[model samples]
Structures are given as structure tokens and as C-alpha cells.
Target: MNTHNLIVGISGASGALYGIRLLEACRDLGVQTHLVISKAGEMTLHHETGLAVSDVRALATKSYKIADIGAAIASGSFRNAGMVIAPCSIRSMSEIATGVTSNLMTRAADVALKERRRLVLMVRESPLHSGHLATMKTLSDLGAIIAPPVPAFYTHPTSLDDMVNHTVGRTLDLLAIENNLAERWDGLKNARTRSQENDGGRD
Candidate 1:
């Protein structure tokens, strides 16, 4: 109900954990989340995370059926912060790119774009063709952010959870969602300079 509301869309991408962790982070911040998972997203959740549909639903402040295109998030008048499609599939990306709102997931993304709100797409695909690159460009031109869950190793992540957390945390940063989920790189370059001075420019 507050302006801090975030609409989350989980598509059929492989990294279902990203979406799950994003919801957990939102709960940690006490930000209300509206979750909508595609049918394939449900299958991926069960396959990869072993989370039942209800389990995923329980992570959010509210859940919506994928086909519920008339949901509040589908309208620009919903007055929310923004939307993020974690583990967004190429199929769903195309739908949002073309303004084809076949379901609530893409419909909400459409609303985010039309209202000039932040729409972060955590696209989860690899070996992309030129078409994929071009669609992402089109979305960027339309003010949608193509934020794939790429891991940052400068923080020296120890595990998969660290990677996911850092990626999710960065995506939240794009929306100005306050969090300390990942270790920030603070003055590392300056520290390296001091270390070089101590070492006399030698190994």
C-alpha cells in the first residue's frame, strides 16, 4: 500500500534463487512486495530450490496468479516504487519489450515502463544471439534496465548464496532499495596504492 511497494516477477529462468533471495531481502527491509510467478517459474522453483508453490507464496507480502492481468499492479494508478523481474526468461522479456501483456507478470512490467518507473529485468540467459542483444537495447531505450544476475568477484564471494546476494543487492541498489546484503568495495584502490608504496613497487 505504501510507495515502497515492489512488484516481483519470477519467470522460467534457471536462477530461481535470485527471486527467492530478493523477496527475503525485501522482507528484511520491511518493504511490501507483490509476487507473481509464471507457470514455468513454479516448475523451476520446485526443480532447483525444492520450494513448493505455497512456499514461494509465503515469502511475499502478497501473491498474484500469473494470469491475473487485471491485478492492481497492472495499472499505472497502482502508485508503487517499481518492478523487478528476477530470473526473467527471454520469452517474458520479449513480451515486455513488445508491450504484449498476455499475463500479469508482463502486464505489471508494462505498467512500470509506461509510468516511467524503474523496471529491472534480471535476465537469466547465456550465449545470447544478436536478437537478444537488440531486444535488451530496445528495452533500455524504453527505460527498462537489463540487469542480469552477474556475479561480482571483487568482494571475494565464498559461496553461491554470496553471489546471489551480491547480485540481488546490486539490483536493489538500482532502485535505491536500502540494504547491506553485500560487502561494498571501499577504498580498495587506495589501499592497493598504499600497499605498493610499502612494497616499493615490487611483489
Candidate 2:
């Protein structure tokens, strides 16, 4: 497997920053990223980040059109580390779960599953219904990871960037890509010790 190559898919989900930051992180880590963004994802990117689709595409090592089902990344033999659907929309999640891919983004994801490669779906939905939960379970049973982009408060994130970085860092960890984007958790004792040390001079 080509561990340096990763497939990044952006669906029509609200947290476009996750996908963008993932791309940037991969770039910094020297990982070659093959990116595909859905039409709806493009709109969400502009609406949420004011970044044109082209700007986001520039961050990736390579970019593909959502309709290009014949793209290299869509093939099982593409030999990438795996695929990640950042901010995966419920629609795309359901499509992949059903094995009825309608576009290159979903198609590449299906390829990853069939190839028995790591497939991470950052499903971004609120108040998921039973049907959605069942769909996620189905994907999990098939060896696909349903990693929603939930933030970790243990990192004491002070900004949106910190939260996003933490999520992206964990996602990268799933692919065995080592990175310092996430703040490692120390033991409770260490945490308390730090707190006490800081309090010694305060009061």
C-alpha cells in the first residue's frame, strides 16, 4: 500500500473547515493527497469559509471532479493509504452504506471498502435518527470507520482552529500518520500537578 498517498473526500456537510484543515495538515506532513469535492460541498465551502473551490483544490496534491468516476483514486488498484470523507453528509454516508455510489467521492470510498483499505467517514449530522444510526452500523460492520468530527475538550481548545486540528489529528492517527496537531493527554495526576503549580502564585 502507498502509505504516502491519501484520498480525501468532501461531501455536503457543514464543517468544511475539517476537510480544509486535513488537506493542509497532510500537505505539511508530506502526504500526497488526492482530493474530490461534491457539488454541494463546493457551495458549503464558499458559504462557510469564503474560499472558492479552486483555493481549496490548491491545497491538495491533486484534485478530481466529483463526476469523474474513472479517476485513479476511484480504482481499487490506486494503492493509497486510504480514504477519508471529511464532514461526510448523511446523504453520502447513506449512499456508501447502500453500495450505491452516485459520484466520484462516494465511488472512491466504495473502492476503499472493497479493497479492504481504511475508509474513514466523518459523518456530520445532528440528532441522527434510527435509520441514520442503522446506516452507520452497516458501514461499521463492513469494516468502514464512522468517525464523526467530535471535538475533545481535554485538549482545552481555545479556538475553532484548535478543535478542528484535534479532530483532523485523530483522523490522521487512524491512518497511522504521526502528527503533532493533537495535544496528547497527560495523566490526571500530571494535569492536577500543572493546575496546582499555576495556582501557587495566583492566590
TM-score of candidate 1 to 2 decimals: 0.92
The superposed Cα distance between candidate 2 and the true structure at residue 168, in angstroms, equals 0.5
lDDT of residue 106 for candidate 1: 95
Residue pairs in steric clash, candidate 1?
Answer: none
In terms of lDDT, model 1 sits at 0.91
lDDT by residue for model 1 over 1-203, one digit each (tens)?
23389999999999999999999999888899999999999999899988898998999999999998888888999978899999999999999999977899999999899999999999999999999999999999999999988899776677998999999889889899888886677798876775678779886
Off by over 4 Å in 2: 1-3, 196-203
Clashes of each: 0, 0
Clashes of 2: 0
* lDDT, candidate 2, at 140: 98
| Clash pairs, model 2 backbone | none
**By lDDT, who's the top model here?**
2
